[model samples]
Target: MLQSTEHCHIVRNSEILSGEPIIRGTRTPVRAIVEMWRIGVSPEEIPQRLPHLVLSQVFDALSYYLDHQVEINEYIEHNRIPDELIDPRVRKA
Candidate 1:
């Protein structure tokens, strides 16, 4: 994994998610944390949702996103699922 100089808990590894910044030791992308926060999951509670993460890792992921909004947002936007793209089995009736 490629360690990031910008944040202690963040790293980029080409083998992982096309090198998107992720929590240092996990495949969880920084954007995943950011999106959870954006949707109103408090940082303290984030660890409850993703048990592998601790509060510090959540904060650092948020910090990394703030420091690199455009980069991370692009990842978010690019990965967003349009309504039409949702699988029929999962779409609400």
Candidate 2:
């Protein structure tokens, strides 16, 4: 499964979640990447933040996101958190 980053097992198709991509074999939403980044988690530290994911998978997801920025951006925009609703703990205070 880790052999082909092209297989990109981290992506999945689902009826719900708007069929938005996800980490393969898990409902661990891919949107977490954007959320983490927004909250200042560096790309290099993503795997450490989510220990279940391999570093390669995290990097690949970012690559995929970059490659399909239009779609990923749309997804992120649609899922944007209202500033008022963001957890103060995560706020850039």
Candidate 3:
């Protein structure tokens, strides 16, 4: 079953992505949407890149990010590969 916040399209369920805020009815994390936007993927392009997500869902994810920057940033950092764990040759400059 899917759950929803009264103000947004984001949802959280313990069984889904370990309870990370995700687009309702999908496992796509809100952080994922923010990261794409941060990397210059426009809202218009997000749905094209992730066809499963409608424009409203992408916008909601971004709105959620704006309202909870620290939370989502922590999630991004926590899930990122540690620099030390990367092979030196494969690490970006």
Q: What is the C-alpha local distance difference test score of each model?
A: 0.93, 0.70, 0.89
Model 1: per-residue Cα lDDT over 1-93, one tens digit each = 485757899999989999999898899999999999999999999999999999999999999899999999999999999989899999889
TM-scores for all predictions: 0.89, 0.70, 0.85
Model 2: per-residue Cα lDDT over 46-89, one tens digit each: 88878888766667677767677788788888988899999899
The 10-residue segment with the lowest total lDDT in model 2:
1-10
Write one digit per residue (lDDT tens) for candidate 3, span 1-93.
456665378998889878889998788999999999998999999999999999999988998888889999999998989999999999989
lDDT of 2: 0.70
lDDT of 1: 0.93
What lDDT is reached at residue 11 by model 1?
91
Residue pairs in collision within model 1 = none
lDDT of model 2 at position 50: 87
Give the TM-score comparing model 1 with the true structure, all chains together: 0.89
**Of 2 and 3, the candidate ranking higher by TM-score:** 3
| Ordered list by TM-score, greatest first | 1, 3, 2
Best by TM-score: 1
Better of 2 and 3 by lDDT: 3
